[model samples]
Target: MQAFDLVSKNISQIIPIPIYVGVFVVLLFQVFPRIFIARQRSIGQSTANRPGKDSDTPNGIYDRKPSLSSLVTPDPTFSWRDNPQQIPREIKPGKYFLTMNVRKLDFNDYIIFDKRYLSEYRERQAIISNVGSARIFVAEANDAALDLCEETLMVTVDFLVTRYPSMFHRTERGVLCVDAGEEYDLVTRPWVRHPLETMCLLSGDDCILMRCCNDGVLRVAAVGLVYSLDIDWTSFVGKDLASIHRDARIPFYESAIQKSVDRYFLKLQPDKPVARANWLTQIGPELRNEKFPDEYFRHVSTIPGNTITPETVVDDLYFRVERQAMRKLPSMRGVVFKFHLYATNIWDLELEEGVPRRFAEHIRGLPESVLRQKHCLEYVDCILKVMDLMAERQEKNTTNFHN
Candidate 1:
C-alpha cells in the first residue's frame, strides 16, 4: 500500500499544475481574442459586402448609385429668349394654357401663407385687406420655372431608367405625392414621395420648367432653376403601395423595379430628411418580413456607410420656415401657405452636429443648370442657409426658433 501511494504521488508530480496553467493562458489571451476578431470580421464582411443581405427578403428594392457611363444631356445654348427683358404681368394663381414654349399643361396653384404675419395682425382688419394678409410671396411667373423643373425630372428619370433598366424595368409606374409622415409601409401604408419640388414635367417631348418666387411677384427671371426629368410613380410602381410590393414579391427583374424606384427618388429627394431623424424606419417592402435581418445592421463601432446611426436618430422633427415666409399674404380667413416649419433640437440625441452642412455641400454640387435658376436658386440657397444656421446654432450652443 505504501509503495502504491508513492507511485501515485510520483505521477501527480510529473503532470505539474504549471503545464495546465500555461495551456489555459494561451487559449484565453492569444487564441480567444483572435477568434472573436475573426468572428467580428466575418460578420462585418457578410453584412457590409452582401448588398441586400440585410434585406429580410431574398428579393427586395434598394438604392443604386448612378454610374459614370450615364450620359449627360447637352444644355441648349443660351438664347435671348432664355430670359425675357420685360417682366411678364403678374399672373394670378389660376389654371392657364398659354404656351410660351413647346410644353404646356393645366397648372394648379398651391397657396402659401405666413403664420407669424397672421398672428401679429390677427385683429387688424384694415391692414389684412390692403396687403392681403401680411407676409406673402407668390410664384406668378412659375411657368418658366415649372417648365425647367419638369424638363430636368424627365431627363433624370429617363437617364436612371435606361442606365439601370434592371431596376426600373417593370411596366408598372408609380405616382409622386407629398406626405407629412416619413416611412414606407408594405403591409398597410404606401410609399409616399414628393414628385415635384424644384422640377416639373407637362408631358413627353415637351420642354418642362419650374420657377421659384417670393414677395408679391416671382423673384428673378430664369434664375435658381433645377433641371431633371420627372417620373410618374404609378407607371413605375403600380397604382398603390400594395400592388407594387405584391409584384415585387415575385423576386426577379420586376422586384428590381423597386430598386430602381428607390434609387431614382433618392437622387430626386437628395436633401430629404433622414427617416431616423424622427426615429422612424423608412417604411418599405423590407419591413414586411416577419423577422428583421439583424445581420445587415451593426452596432456601428465606426461611422455607418449607408444606414443611419441610432445616436444621430432624431426623435424630434424640425420643419423649417424660410426667409421667404417674410412675404406671407393673409387670406380671407388665414394665410395662403398653410404649413409652417416646425423644429426641435438634434443635440438632444447625443450626436455630433454639423450634419446639415455636410448635406448642403453634397446638394450644392449637383449640375449647375439645376442650381443656377433665379427663383429656384433663391429658394435652394434659403433652405441651405437655414440648414447651415441650424448647425451653427447647435455648435454655438444656442437656441433656434422659427416663427
Candidate 2:
C-alpha cells in the first residue's frame, strides 16, 4: 500500500492530469465522428460496388408505336371547289333558310349564329361557327328553358364528330376536332350538351352576328354581297412572315422579354456608355475579346392603376427585356418577369390576413370570360406578368427607335 501511494504521487508530479483529459476529450468530440462517418460510407460504397444482382432485367415492356388499324382508316374525299353548297335547295314554308349574303369575310373572321333555324320535323336550336375563310363549320346547340329568355348555349363538337366526321382530323400540325368534352372542362356537365372549344372558332376585328338553327346546322354567311380577295402572285415572302409573327405577337411572354435585348449589345462597349447615350455605338475592347459579364439586365417600372394601388400592393409590373446575346438576332426572343412588391407600411396591413378581399375583387373584375371561369391567383399573376412584359417591350422599343 505504501509503494502504490508513492507511485501515484510520482506520476502526478511528472505530468499535468487536467491537460491530458482535455486533449482526450477534444479528440473524442472533434475527430471520431468524421472518421466513423468516412468508414461507414466506404463500407457501404464497397458493398454497393460488389455486383448487380441476377434479377435486374426488364422482361416484357410493350412498345408504344401506332398500329396499322389506327393509321389506315378510310375518310371521305371531299374537295372544297368541286363540292357544291350543301345547304337544302328548297326552303319550305315555316322552315327558315339560315342564309345571309355577307359582303366580305376573311381567314381570321368569326361569325356567330344568333338567329335560330327552324324545322317542323325536329325541335332543336344550334349555333353555327364559320371559322376563318375555310369551308369548315362548327355548330353549337342551345335549348330553351321553361322561359325562352332563359336559354342555355351548348357547343356542337360531338354533333360535328358524329354528323360531320369529315370535318375533323389529327393533322401534322394539330388536332382539328372540337372535342370539347375531352379537351376542356366546360363541357363536362350533363346540362351542357354542347361546349365550344376556343380553337374550333376563329374571329377577327369585324362585325359579325351570332346566329342559331333548329336542324342541328348553323351558318354564318356574310351580310350584303360576298367579296373574295385573291392574293397577287409574288406578294408573299413565305418564311419572313414566320419571323415577323415571332417578333410581334407570338403568344405568352417570351416575345415581350426580348424587346430590350439590344441593350446587351450596347453593354458590350467597355467604356460603358451613359444611360442616355447610344449603347450600340460603343462596342468596347472586351467585346473584341468576347468577354462579357456573367449576368446582365436592365430595369423598367410602371405603377398599377388606382384600383390595385395599396400601401403594400402587388407589384404587377412587367418588362420586355431583350435576349440577343444568347443567340442570333432573329432567334433571341423576349422574356417577361412578373413579380409583386409588398408595401411594408400601410393602414389595413393587418387586413391582408384572410383570403385577401382585394385579390378576390381583382379576380372578380377580369375582362375575359374564359379567364374568369378558371379564376386563380397563379393564372392572374402569370397573365399580368405577360402583359407587363409586352408593355415594357413596346415602350422600350418605342424609346429606342425614337432616340
- Pick by TM-score: which candidate is best? 1
Q: Model 2 segments beyond 4 Å from truth?
A: 1-9, 55-362, 365-403
Flag regions of model 1 displaced more than 4 Å: 1-11, 53-403
How many clashing residue pairs appear in each of the predictions shown? 68, 32
How close to the true structure is residue 207 of candidate 1, measured as C-alpha lDDT?
Answer: 17
Candidate 2 weakest lDDT stretch, 10 residues: 322-331
Over 190-236, each residue of candidate 2 has an lDDT whose tens digit, in order, gives 52322222222311001111122243221221110001112221222
- Superposed Cα deviation of residue 290, candidate 1 (Å): 52
Give the distance in Å from residue 43's predicted Cα in candidate 1 to where it truly belongs.
Answer: 2.1
Q: Relative to the unseen true structure, what is the C-alpha lDDT of residue 47 in candidate 2, on a scale of 0 to 100?
A: 51
Deviation from native of the Cα of residue 333 in model 2, angstroms: 33
Against the reference, the lDDT scores of all candidates come to 0.29, 0.26
